[model samples]
Target: MQDEAFFDETEQLEEASSAPTDTAARKRAWRLRINYRFIVQHTPYILFLSGLALVYIANIHYTEKKIWDINRLDKEIRELKWDYISRKSDLMYNSKMSEVSDKVSGQGLKPLNTPPQKIEVEKK
Candidate 1:
């Protein structure tokens, strides 16, 4: 009789524990279904907004690169202009008619001994 009671008590305990496990499984399944439904409902909007953000970021990066290129070109242009002006000044300071004549002679062009007389034409 004592052994029969012990067996009955063990079976009751096992049934009680398995009942809670089944309840927990049902709760977890319900939560998963809710999460899936929420994601399915909002997926399109989420994807669209992500695409727009990516495009905006790409445009900003391209504009930044272009601005940097323009700044670099401006600096280079200023340096070239400065070099040109300095060289022009040096040429103006050093150039002379006699030196030009010497350079012309070196290039095989003979210098005229006398200035040519000018002729003026009147327009009617």
Candidate 2:
């Protein structure tokens, strides 16, 4: 019985060797190196790694967005500072005694040329 089974296996091997060497057929005959048990056991670790990678990517994006916002805010602050300086200078120039007289002159107002005399009243 052993000799007959071995002889039949050799014959099958010879028949397969004589068969056409089709690349498509060979590709379809691929075998797994890992077992299903190992895959199922390590699935939780794979999912954890995937979750960590996603969190890392999200953190990078959030950091980049914060950097962009900081740059934008820096530009806005610079512009506002310049505006503040210019407005302050304009206010200083416009609040001078000369400018105040000039503006009020159009409305028929004039500056006093002499000091006013003080009068003392006695209470009776």
Candidate 3:
């Protein structure tokens, strides 16, 4: 008897839904409706997830900035190292004995022409 009643209700519902206008009406009723209570209940969790996403994005940007900075510093260091080597080589060339003599020639300084004479003196 209970099953007959249930089946009767289902038959009526199916018959009502079979009409095109009824189906459209049912579709309209089934349209999504916002549940504000659900949103309010899970607001914190949603905010936390949003925050996590922002932090993840920020971390990637920070890492990329650090990488760029490191690469720039490396390039600068290499340039400075090359400059240092060039200046050191220039200094070494300028300090050679032959180079020193040539530079001092303009100042009336001359290189030794002969070996130094060692003089011996009698002790008093």
Candidate 4:
């Protein structure tokens, strides 16, 4: 009877291995059933990891946006500095006496031709 049971078990094993498609289908069904169990067991951990991933992704995007804004502001600051320097130099050039005289010359305002002497008064 033991030998017959062993033979029957071996025959069942042989039948199970005989069809690859059937074995694969059984494996697929088993995996599908286990997938539900896996999710049920680890759902909280999965949700925690998902939240961490979202925070990580959002932090990366926020940092990148901040860096982009910093770069843009740096570029604008450089341009403004250049403009300030240019305007200051232009103001200095226009403030010179020669340029002032030239601008006023067109308005019929002439520069002094000679230096004047101060008069000395004696108390009597």
Could you say which candidate leads in TM-score? 4
Q: In model 1, where is the ten-residue run with the lowest total lDDT?
A: 93-102
List lDDT for all candidates, in order: 0.91, 0.88, 0.90, 0.95
Model 3: per-residue Cα lDDT over 2-72, one tens digit each: 99999999999888778789878776665533356557778999999999999999999999999999999
Model 1 over residues 1-124: C-alpha lDDT tens digits? 9999999999999989898989899889888877997678889988999999999999999999999999999999999999999999889766877777777887798768899989999999
Candidate 4 residue 101 C-alpha distance from true site, Å: 0.3
Which residue pairs overlap in candidate 2's backbone?
none
lDDT per residue as tens, model 2, 1-124:
9999999999998877866675446545542314565567799998999999999999999999999999999999999999999999999999999999999999999999999889999999
Off by over 4 Å in 2: 1-31, 35-38, 116-124
Candidate with better TM-score, 1 vs 2: 2
**Count of backbone clashes for each model?**
0, 0, 0, 0
Which regions of candidate 4 fall more than 4 Å away from where they truly are?
1-33, 113-124
Look at candidate 1 and give me any clashing residue pairs: none
Stretches of candidate 1 off by over 4 Å are 1-34, 97-124
Better of 2 and 4 by lDDT: 4
Give the distance in Å from residue 17's predicted Cα in candidate 1 to where it truly belongs: 25
Q: TM-score per candidate, in order?
A: 0.52, 0.63, 0.66, 0.67
Candidate 3, which segments miss by more than 4 Å at Cα? 1-35, 114-124
lDDT of 4 by residue, 19-86 (tens): 78888988999998789988898999999999999999999999999999999999999999999999
For model 4 the TM-score comes to 0.67
Identify the leading candidate in terms of lDDT: 4
lDDT of 4: 0.95
